[model samples]
Target: MEEFSPRILPLLWRRSVPARRAVGRPPRLSVDIVVTTAIRLADTEGLEAASMARVAAELSVATMSLYTYVPSRPELVDLMVDEVLWARGLTSDGTFRERVLLYAERTFAMYRAHPWLAEVPRARPPVGPGMLAEQEYVLAAVATLGLPVRELNRAAAGITTWVTSAARHEAESALLRRTTGLSSDEWWQQRGELWENWFDVGSHPTMTMIWNAGAFDRGADQQAQDAYEYGLGLLLAGIERSVEGDDRVP
Candidate 1:
């Protein structure tokens, strides 16, 4: 398994100037526009490319105009995240494993929809109604696992962390392919040229086997949900196996 990225809690901050609400004035704007504009910026230019100025430029509004709709970039991010995460969800009307798998698939779908989401830190928990609903639904799905709250929390965190780590890998790999002008499969086909001379026969048999099978075959599927589900099953299976001898899971 690949290692997890250092727990990066990228700071989300509010815009410095607060919206000035004049006495006896109605609300200046709706939250929907602010949320949608922020999401569009992220989807198009990437998360780091999104800022108040960029969002305003996208919306064709003055930068100060957004303050009335959102307090700050962090608040806008919170809202944008909530909007996308709930676009689809899982149900609890199935076996625990089935339900968890469905949830895992749904989680990956959102990340695939907006790749930047996988990079957002969960420093401050999502508090929007949609995000709360997603959390509640996931919690309910794992209820049958019979693990303590902390253990269940850890399991959920592990699954999500794994998803993001994998997504980051695929995203970076895609960028490298574009930059170096070589598909992963092409890179793998020629990788031996770089190290075939140094590879020892006995110690590198495993690598040789993968190379023979085209180890660089990144799935050509538009969505990587199946890959995510496959990994989720292995993780859940390992946990189940570990708990079998213990009296923890009934």
Candidate 2:
């Protein structure tokens, strides 16, 4: 059996080996054109809809020609993710918390704009210029806290992890509602009778008390937004305390 090669790192880093000169007219397509077409396809439809054949059709080129620019679908998706990130660059202009909040807001908005982004598996993220720009922006903001290098890195990672996770969840939820033609609230409401029949107040006393108190009355969108803001506030508070050398932070 042959080992699989991603063949994406070089392309992402713009260090790909030059192709052999073909004995024909210069090719009309470039990597930028290919990636841009794929991104556009993924943005309107879902990521899965942007297959090589579809992209080639959009580009008016042969399907096999796309492979010459982007090795495979996985590589194209990686490129698409990085391109979107690059387009939504972060800013470091503001106070610590404000800057961090702006970063989170921008990231969330990006995910909302391109919901397919949440579907991409980024365990090994593309090391492209866009990814580096985002990392630098966050690290610079966190570095202002005057912590040691290790603590600074950890703080930056924590902020990024929290924001990305929250944004992904929000994006996925939106995509689900769009695809299923039913908002989360509507879906739950449809199951109201089932809940009324199966839910046992005695079994879940705390939940029953909350439900009776109107704690869950908010719409799903509002609830999700509120939860995101609340969690972000807590994260910001913890960072502030850590900077102040609060022993209770641990």
Candidate 3:
């Protein structure tokens, strides 16, 4: 068995790939090019579609040539994830909550841009430089909240979890719409009627009451953008309470 080295595929930053031969003409291929092509393939199709052969085909190069720069598929995927995570723009200005919200929004937008990111498995801890930079940015934003190290780590994790899940849902909704040829409203409208026809409203009074109130229509599914904002607001409120040292439930 052999250990993995992080230096094998350094695609976290925008840099040219090492030339195949040390004393020859500039390398025609670069790691950045490979990773970018890989990301584009994943974005257009899905993660599974971004195979090394497919990426090499897109790059007009031989599959084995790619291995010269990128060690393997898993390494390439790691580079891709780090590259996108590095794209998140974090700011330390503004109040703590404001900074956190801005960071979360930017992170969410990044996930939406590269939805296939959710498909990547975290088999090991993130040891890439880009991931470390992101963690530092997040920790700095929440450092002033007067939280213990454990609580601070938990808060950051919670924020990332919420943003990732929300953005993944958004991406999935878009994919579903493309596959089904139906908008959210259209899909839900058909399902709403089925529920109306099949369910005994008399027995489920609470559900019936809410349904009659048009809550679901005006709720989470109607406008995902609004739903995201609403959820973010609630999450921010909870974070605010935690910051104020009132994290305990009533």
Candidate 4:
């Protein structure tokens, strides 16, 4: 067997894609044109629907023509995510909940609106301003804690990761639940009829109370709150703990 241990990789994965100030014959494509082309392709068709070739066609150019702009698929998607995210403006005036909630909801809405965007694998040293704005917003909310810049970075990253992961999980689980005619709720309800009855009233008193309460509403199903409030609240609470405890910034 041949041991092909390691290899060189494209700089796209290593360094930030350099910002281009020109488009067409001037030696670069306008970042807006490149990003907009990507967004239009992804939006009209789907994430999978957008490709360098397809985007070029959408732009009425040769497939090789796009190479003058985005270097690769990952780079293109990064551009598109950042481009589409620009619609979510950042506000600095709100309280902890308000500011943080704004970031979280914006992130969740973007990913939910483009489910495929949630699946991209990110690299260290984020490369887009839209994402950078999100981090800024999150840190601004926690600035009162007076944490070191590094700790603030961690808090902001937590908020970012929480929104992306939660939205992805929610979308996937909803799809799976729908595939089965009976949701997890219906399955759990039927569990009571099973012979082994793990949720029997005598064995599970708490569950019985929950079942009786009917907390799970199938139609008009609502989260305790939308993803923004839910995720933002969690991060704000975490910051509160850090502030109140020995975890103060160094």
lDDT against the true structure, each candidate: 0.64, 0.83, 0.74, 0.63
lDDT of 4: 0.63
Over 46-154, each residue of candidate 2 has an lDDT whose tens digit, in order, gives: 8888999999999999899889999888788888888888887676677888779888888998998899988887677787878888889888898787666777777
lDDT of 3 by residue, 24-116 (tens): 688898888998899998988888888999999998999999999888887788888888877775656777777877777777787678878
TM-scores of the candidates in the order shown: 0.68, 0.90, 0.82, 0.66
> Which candidate number maximizes TM-score?
2
Instruction: Give one digit per residue, the lDDT tens place, for model 4 in 13-58.
Output: 3235555566666744544676677777665556776788888887
Question: Mind giving the per-residue lDDT tens digits that candidate 1 earns over 20-99?
Answer: 66689665456767677778777776786678888778778888987766767766777778777666654568976777
For model 4 the local lDDT of residue 190 reads 68
lDDT for model 3, please. Answer: 0.74
Q: What is the C-alpha local distance difference test score of candidate 2?
A: 0.83
Among residues 3 or more apart in sequence or in different chains, the pairs in candidate 2 whose N, CA or C atoms overlap within 3 Å are none
Q: Which candidate is the best by lDDT?
A: 2
Model 2's C-alpha root-mean-square deviation from the true structure amounts to 3.0
Error of model 3, residue 167, in angstroms = 0.9
Task: Give the Cα error of residue 205 in candidate 2, in Å.
Answer: 1.3
Decide which is better by lDDT, 2 or 3.
Answer: 2
Q: Rank the candidates by lDDT, best first.
A: 2, 3, 1, 4
